[model samples]
Target: MVKRDGLKWWFTVAMVAACWRKGVAAEAQASAIWVMGDSLIDSGNNNFLNSWAKADYYPYGIDYYRGPSGRFTNARTFSDILGDWLEVAAPPPFSSPTTAGRRILGGVNYASAAGGILDETGQHYGARYSLNQQVVNFETTLGQLRAMMSPANVTQLLTNSIIIVGFGSNDYINNYLMPNLYASSRNYNPEAFANLLLNHYARQLQALYSLGLRKFFLAGVGPLGCIPNQLATGQAATGNCVETVNQIIGSFNDGLRRLVGQFNDGSHPGAMFVYGNTYGVFRDILNTPARYGFTVKDRACCGIGRNRGQITCLPLATPCFNRDQFVFWDAFHPTQAANVVLAQRAYSGSTTDVYPINVQQLAQMRL
Candidate 1:
């Protein structure tokens, strides 16, 4: 009788343990957002990476509540805006010492300044996390979550999580077209280089898939030649957008969208890729700055030059009287107001704004 009673007691304890573990797993999956990419989406990860591509200083975050929170942009990035639209708090940087424990339950941002699709794309910055490295860093977070819940549940959480990735611009501007060191453009045609970038980028996305991420929000390179820095330096010959460079950017965005279609059309089962139409969205804003409540589309709000470009916003750099009237905050990044406009379109705009369905649709998808 004693032996039988002991078996019953052990059985009850086992059942209770299983129930508790399942509950933990369920909580992790209810739809979290995990960010991975370059400075465009970085929310302070570069601060921990000790890279010069950082933005955690004066004038960088003057628009943010905490000020210069290390985001490349002047204020909240599009990641933050999208999260707010979904009613999910923006994830804290995974590298932050202050970000840990249940607070991490919101999510984690692993983007770094100067990061690119290709590992060698941003070496000049010194100490940027490549796209592949960001995925590896995500593996570390998966381990932490697995310890709290079952591995299967952890996978479930990732499969349902929203992932936003923005990269590749630096690969062209910083590597292929840099004045002194690299000569990739001379070696390969624009179309060929764009193809090379997409090839590697496709593989990176596949790696994320292997780790159970199913919902992907992939943004193609923006109109690079139109950014203030490009016009001030390389394309100054025309004092207008380098149309050839923009053509290359278009090729990449087209290729990226094709890849997304491949994933959705049964190439990768259970994967959903929403290509954020940054190329079109940004071009629209630039073409009609007043339509978006801006007067200055070419000049950066916080730099010194014909366009407040030539240099990124530096420490104590003078800023514009109205950040809202400017589309760009620095030489490269969009101002917070501009980001909000982009996020709104990406959240629920027409098919032209966000192909394959908007982020709002992706978030509500079952499975």
Candidate 2:
């Protein structure tokens, strides 16, 4: 195989090994996988919310298991695919009435569409569950668990569990850079805004730590400028990435990595913060789509306007028949095909893909 092909094959092997370990780990642990984040991990909460940012219609979930279960993507997201790889079941969305009973045992998804680390971010979308709100909701879940089982059992279940978090993108895209709706960009430069976001995010994670969370799978900001939405809307849309947006994302990601190190080194004892390289993973696929089995790397499979991304997939939008060929399902989300690849990388890949330790190593760690 050529050098590029060899690298791709190496990644494939790592993905395969990561997945294969799930079956083995299933018998060795009593852990669950919890999810928290923005649209990337939102299963269906936005459906019930009054947000304009919703994916409860057709063509949106054209590639999903339930046709359109309100996920932001066209099919299984990183959360679902990662859960499957870890041999942990998909957690019910927190907003779902059915999330009660033993369903919470597996874990629960507290992510929301257009969610952000800051409460004021993404208000244009309406009732998005901010990270604080999600944690507040988690407190309620903890209450429910305490009622359902012994304190020791609840503690055991939570301490060993891995809670994956994917946020930050919307704070930039939906808030600071959101045209004229927000004056945040005028108020804060990229560095200042990044510091603001990082400080707030650190508090949120610390809150989770206070609530008994020990293992955290934190996803960094991806190459936001290359997303079809940014390409179609930003000035750097003409066959190139929006360098400004990418720079902003890099600032946030850098701070996030430093924060992760602090959390692991001292801020929280016995804590495991595995940084998930959402940026590098997406960048790789974007750089060489063919190597990753992707053909349409710059357009949404279902949307309207430039690159089918100016607007999201509308109700009854005619979606591309070849969903797998496209990297994006809508303006701001990856297609299921891409997510499947990222999930494998998140669970077990090199430091370039996942940092400190992958989800597999983090899961098996006794601390």
Candidate 3:
């Protein structure tokens, strides 16, 4: 029999080897995570843009290790948390000057604040990259990848990678909903508006698919009616959400879900489209805040006015110390704590959170 010290040494070595193998397996499962969305997943692309919907100020990254990295949340965004679970490094923003060279191999984040599916959605907010523009940016990234490796190799890399597309919220929140500034509301009803957005969205997805993208995580819009910004408007009664707004957003999400089904019906060969039910997940959290370890679910931890949402968090604004207890970070975005829940659900949740299969399964799918 081996001595106790020898057994201990062998056990430690085995544990280390097992951990190394797990890490390798995770990294091999998904070569990269290409994120494309609005402020919810934007890492810092808006910092480079001349837009008013920026969040590169104090209290934004207070809970993050790298303070104030331009993320709208207090810490990591949904994509950042998902990357941590996948053992993949968070992709630097395409607008970042240092996103060239070997860094392009990991992936690239093309999300921008106030960005929407429609090109004219956030035009009033100044320069913001719409979903179509983000796709064009991805094309540029693909071009750089071709320069670094053979075109076939780049294609293979992308086929094995996962691309997240989260839009539509800004189209409603900043466009259709803001009737004073945009003609979308006057031009089309809710159903017609959703169809128009979906048409544009379908074309954009086809463009990405044409470029060799296979695995897609289509995140549906969340319950915007429950956000502190909407609550501050007095449209919703105290401690209650605006059901009308939620119903309107729900129609868009329903169309988006069907679109995912259409894409998976052999229309796009080798393409696996998964619909992330952001609406359901967020509503679940809201309905039972205690289950998520949140106390202040109605108001924002930062911001000013009624629900602390009349104005978003200002520069050097003193945020709540109990940020983890609050659901909203500012008027719009979720706290890092809430982001953790959203990412976890999308990464390994059931059909109720992410339909068909979650991100973990999507990553393992060898397309």
Candidate 4:
């Protein structure tokens, strides 16, 4: 009887030890992910700045974290939603000196509104920092991380970090398409414009790869034709999506996917890149706005006037009755509820309409 009891106790201890070891290994697998991109990922990084593309104050984060106004920081953009997932499921911190119990679960977001991959595009937006400058910012962020941990820890950060890049919208809207509508540069061809943009984007990605970034989640440009701003300003009819602008978006995404395939086939092991198809996601929402609890899919929720299309959602404008029922918050930006749906699609890998390579596939890639 005594021998049997001792054996049982030993087996329990062994199982517990094994479980702990497995837990530690899992934790080590997901050390830290880094996110860098443009306004789509910029929570409030530009809110402090004097810019038209800003979301620093009230009503923005109202629906987030149970109606809390100040829930999201400048770094907590849409891409950072993945960080929330990591925080909940990632294992406990490693016992190494590098981690220092700093909880390597969640990532840091350095996305800024109006940020672009090219310096010229940045100049067009009158932004303080370009994509290269944002890369510098990321380097600085990594330097800070290095100061907190050892070289091994730094390696863990580099190897495990899932870099997410969400851009191209600002370039299309503020720089190319919108400018062509009003300026003498209207002679610009969409195909040539897309090529110029993609060339710069390719260089930026290569720069990041050279700096040890392996994993990437890139959000492609959405259906620019369906945005409320375009519909209102460009005189698009109700229930109609702008086909010409969407064609340009499609071309850009195709080129981007090819570039990603090249990277995957190259020497970088475990390096994976996937697109976040905001276009398809938004299209679905526009097609069946009621499914997502949205009533006004083609109009601004916070702008003034009965047309709902002519007004801009500013301090002087009247706010909507139910923001949750609206897809767009202003002339250009999406509402918080729309962002939530987009985040869910991006996370659950249902955004195949936007990204051909889902998160699960990217996560399974061998480093």
Off by over 4 Å in 2: 1-30
Which candidate has the highest TM-score of all? 3
| Pairs that collide, model 3 | none
Name the candidate that leads on lDDT. 3
For model 2, where is the 10-residue window of minimal lDDT?
A: 1-10
lDDT of 3 by residue, 1-367 (tens): 1333443354356446545866677344578889999999999999999999888889899988988988998998989877766667789999999999999898999999999999988888899999999999999999899989997899889998988889999999999999999999999999999999999999999999999999999999999999999998899955668778898887899999999999999989988999999999999888888776788898899999989989999999999998878889999999987887788789888988887899989988877
Which tens-of-lDDT digit does each residue in 257-360 have in candidate 1? 99888878988788898898899999988887766667878778888776777877999877887887788888888988788778878988889999989998
Give a tens-digit lDDT track for model 4, residues 183-267: 4136557766667778888888877887777778887787877776677665454456667778867877777777676767765
Q: How many residue pairs clash in each candidate?
A: 1, 0, 0, 2
User: TM-score for each prediction?
Assistant: 0.89, 0.92, 0.93, 0.78
Candidate number with the higher lDDT (1 or 3):
3
| TM-score of structure candidate 1 | 0.89
Q: Rate the local accuracy (lDDT) of all candidates.
A: 0.81, 0.85, 0.88, 0.61
Candidate 2, 96-188: lDDT as tens digits: 888998999889999999899999889988998999899999999999999999989988899889999999988998898875998889999
Rank the candidate models, highest lDDT first.
3, 2, 1, 4
CA error at residue 24 for candidate 3, angstroms: 6.4
Residue 12, candidate 2: C-alpha displacement in angstroms: 12
Worst 10 residues of 3 by lDDT: 1-10
- Runs in model 1 deviating more than 4 A are 1-30, 234-240
